[model samples]
Target: MASQIQYADVEVGTELPAASFPVTRATLVQYAGASGDFNPIHWNEKFAKGVGLPDVIAHGMFTMAEAIRVVTDWVGDPGAVVEYGVRFTRPVVVPNDDRGGLIEVTAKVAAKLDDNRVRVDLTAMSAGQKVLGMSRAVVELA
Candidate 1:
């Protein structure tokens, strides 16, 4: 386990070390297997493109889950997360070829919500467009 981040250490408007998680068809399929979210739009590019999207779309929850790695890693434990939510602002399209569409996720401490908690705002992008936005979470510190 990593060293615990003390509550006194964080300040309002501080930024967390950002992270990036790439998305691909295989990852979407793997996530579907592990998370039980096997939406066709996540893995089937043809089906997605047929429906008018640029390509296969990553699952909304899948994107959120990957982005949480940055927060949980920074906070040093998953248990530190009090609440997390994100509005699906855009679909993260995964290209069919190898390497797929890479999602870049950056986060910052938006505010000190309470004595032991801070609100973290996240932004995820892919293909030079916003894939996830208005993403916020509350984390408790030791």
Candidate 2:
């Protein structure tokens, strides 16, 4: 299938719409169950604090997936993403409050490649700190 977004319309440095994902303790639990990553650092606050973390943290993979929503939402096809990766720079701390925390994601086209593909650079932040660095996605567009 072709991407809903035409590669011709996407220019270098074009910013995609930003999105914020709420990461609650409950969200972590559900993700743990779905992904089978039942690590205590993602759920147990005491354990997380014991490890010198500020509080319970969201899973790295979860944060990565959340960050890519900006690209997937813009491209309108998950399969259009040919490659994606990121470096976990900081933990996304999740408070036990009703609001929990927010993972704010923003992405921009960094380069246009051959074969209708574009390299998207992404930034994921939480609590005023950069959580994901060097985040990027290579997508095949129409």
Candidate 3:
């Protein structure tokens, strides 16, 4: 797919628009069913606490997907993302409530690379704490 972003216009240290994703208990349940990861820590608060977790936690993969939307949305094509990676620094405790939790993501173009590519650095935070560390993506621009 062709990228919506033009490589000639991209600049190092350009900040993309920030985005936020809500993580509810139901979200975790649906993700578990879809991913076949029936981990109790992601759905059962009691089991999560018993396992030494603060509460029911959102799946790391789910969080990663949510964070990358900032990049994909900006590039306007999922295929534009040629490489992506992140370190799970903290658990996003999704409380069993209507409000649940919110994951806030902010990203900036870190560097312009050869072959019409750029490195984007991402920051993911929840509940006033950083949840993902060293999150970065390489995208090919049109």
Model 2 residue runs over 4 Å out of place are none
**Backbone clashes in model 1, listed as residue pairs:** none
Q: lDDT (CA) for every model shown?
A: 0.84, 0.94, 0.95
lDDT of 1 by residue, 26-88 (tens): 888998999998878888878888889888888988888988888998978898888898888
Error of 2 at 19 (Å): 0.4
Candidate 2 accuracy as lDDT: 0.94
Q: Which clashing pairs does model 2 show?
A: none
| TM-score (C-alpha, index-matched) for candidate 2 | 0.98
lDDT of 2 by residue, 1-142 (tens): 5689998998999999999999999999999999999999999999999999999999999999899999989988899999999999999989999999899999999999999999999999999999999899999999
TM-score of each: 0.92, 0.98, 0.98
C-alpha root-mean-square deviation, candidate 2: 0.7
lDDT of 3 at 18: 100
Which runs in model 3 stand beyond 4 Å of their true positions?
none
> What's the distance in Å from true for residue 9, model 1?
0.9
Q: What is the lDDT of residue 84 in candidate 3?
A: 98
